[model samples]
Target: MNIRLRSAVAGDYDAVNAIIREGQDEHAEALPDRFARLDQVVAMGWYRSFSKQPNKEIIVAECGDKLVGVAMLEMKQSPSFEALVPRTYAYLNELAVASTHQRQGIGKKLYTASLAWARERGASSLELNVWEFNERAQQFYASVGMRTLHRMLFTDLT
Candidate 1:
């Protein structure tokens, strides 16, 4: 497969959004209550903002002119709560491979490209979050050599 990896352009909005929606569907399967299907408007708004961010990048994996995967990255500086230094890092905000093309290494290629982009931009680390119940995603992240830096727990008080 002659899959091409490149930065997302304006015309890629719909394809990228579709991939993310597929991701949301996967997440919703894990938590039907908390991860309900997102409205296209909301998803599009978020994607538009991410796309326009000066320090953010939306990368796409396309095969024969069809977008098969997408990964969004942002350059961020974390608050120095543990130390006196503010550390710059790369935040992986979103990543998804087309349902039809998953497990074919498209996701891996997107991740590898994003990592290289982050490193080239002088980021000290790369970080991303996956819901606790998404075992598949957790495994994927771990397989890519990412260790959990923290955990977030929530409880319903109603």
Candidate 2:
């Protein structure tokens, strides 16, 4: 029952990646191959680049020194499409929890920590994307006060 969460260090990349793979496997039956591969690679690369970017933060949840979850936050500027909104925003690009520890508040703790981290950095808004068919994820976000604002579609050229 003892669990802790903290910002990811360079040494935690592999653990973070492992958590991602495990979480993805839980929904592999519903995800497109291209979506799956590209997202995984992008997540790994984020960890690799974390050392160079002061604005990008990736946090890991650990239990007795073992990484069980990860959350990534990036300082972002509002897109031009939304001319009415402020420019400074926060993007939560990724958040994954190991299936073994899910629903035990590990994911919530990671999210809460990431939110505080984003706020401390002067982010005006926080945003993230979930796959359209991932109802479980959408429900989680909703329970956390996030609303469905738009629908995002994708296609594979390969």
Candidate 3:
């Protein structure tokens, strides 16, 4: 299958939202308390606002006339704290492939493109946060040469 990667256009909002919804559904199912299923409009609105940010971008993978995947990326700077070194980095906010098109290497392609994008912007590193419950996502990230930088622990109070 021939797939093309490009910066998302205004017309691609709905397709992007659909792919995002697929990922969101998995998150909601895996951790109902932390994630709630979102309406399409709500998702689209959030996407719209995110896409408008100067330091953010939504990249899409197109197969023929259809959009099959998306990656949301942002260029961010570490806060200026006395204990922390100041640096710029690329954050992978979200990466999702339509359920029908997953496992066909679309996600990997998107990841490669994301790295290139970061490098082009002179980012010191590419970073992201993946929940512990999402083992599949963690495995995928590991396969892509991403190692855990740190872990976030939490406690539940009933």
Candidate 4:
């Protein structure tokens, strides 16, 4: 397929949201209910605010006029989880390619664009969370030189 990579615009939100919803469904099916609540959270407007944040960006890969992949980035000073926190970082909130487009390099292209955006802004590190069982994603991240830094655990308070 002929794919074009570009920065996202406000007009792209619907397509971006569709990709997110589909990705989240697959993600939810593989995880516990606690984390699955993200589908609802995103649907209720959380992700809508992401692109508006000063430090956040969303990129899309399009085949003709159709969006085939997306990557979302959040750049910020490293939070002081401890008093001795390190340098600035970019958080990769989401990176997804349409299931039909897997293995076509859309995800990688989107990731490359995101990394350039982060590096241009002086971020020292780029971080993201991938489910432990997502071996394909793990391999992709590893291929692009992302190392596992931490494991996130979730609990349901509801």
Top model number, TM-score = 3
TM-score of each: 0.90, 0.85, 0.93, 0.84
Clashing pairs in 3: none
Question: Candidates sorted by TM-score, descending order?
Answer: 3, 1, 2, 4
Per residue, candidate 3 scores C-alpha lDDT tens digits across 21-127 of 88888889999999989868236676776668867888899999999999999999999999999999999988999999989999999999999999999999999
lDDT of 4 by residue, 1-158 (tens): 79898778777777787778776776677775524635333443555666667788878899987899999888877667788667888989899888878899888888888889899888988889888767889999999889988787777677
Against the correct fold, how does model 1 do in TM-score? Answer: 0.90
lDDT of each: 0.86, 0.79, 0.89, 0.80
lDDT of 2 by residue, 1-158 (tens): 88887777878877777778765665575765634533454465657776579888888888897888989888987666865665787888889898888899988888888889888989876889888778889899898888877886777677
Q: Which stretches of candidate 3 lie over 4 Å from their true place?
A: 41-45, 49-54
Off by over 4 Å in 2: 26-28, 36-45, 80-84, 153-158
TM-score winner, 1 or 3: 3
Q: Quick one: RMSD of model 1?
A: 1.9
By lDDT: ranked, best first: 3, 1, 4, 2
| Tens digit per residue, CA lDDT, model 1, 1-158 | 88899988878988887888887887787778778786561266676776688789999999997999999999999886976588899999888899899898898899999899899999999999988877888888889898999899888886
Count the clashes in each prediction.
Answer: 0, 0, 0, 0
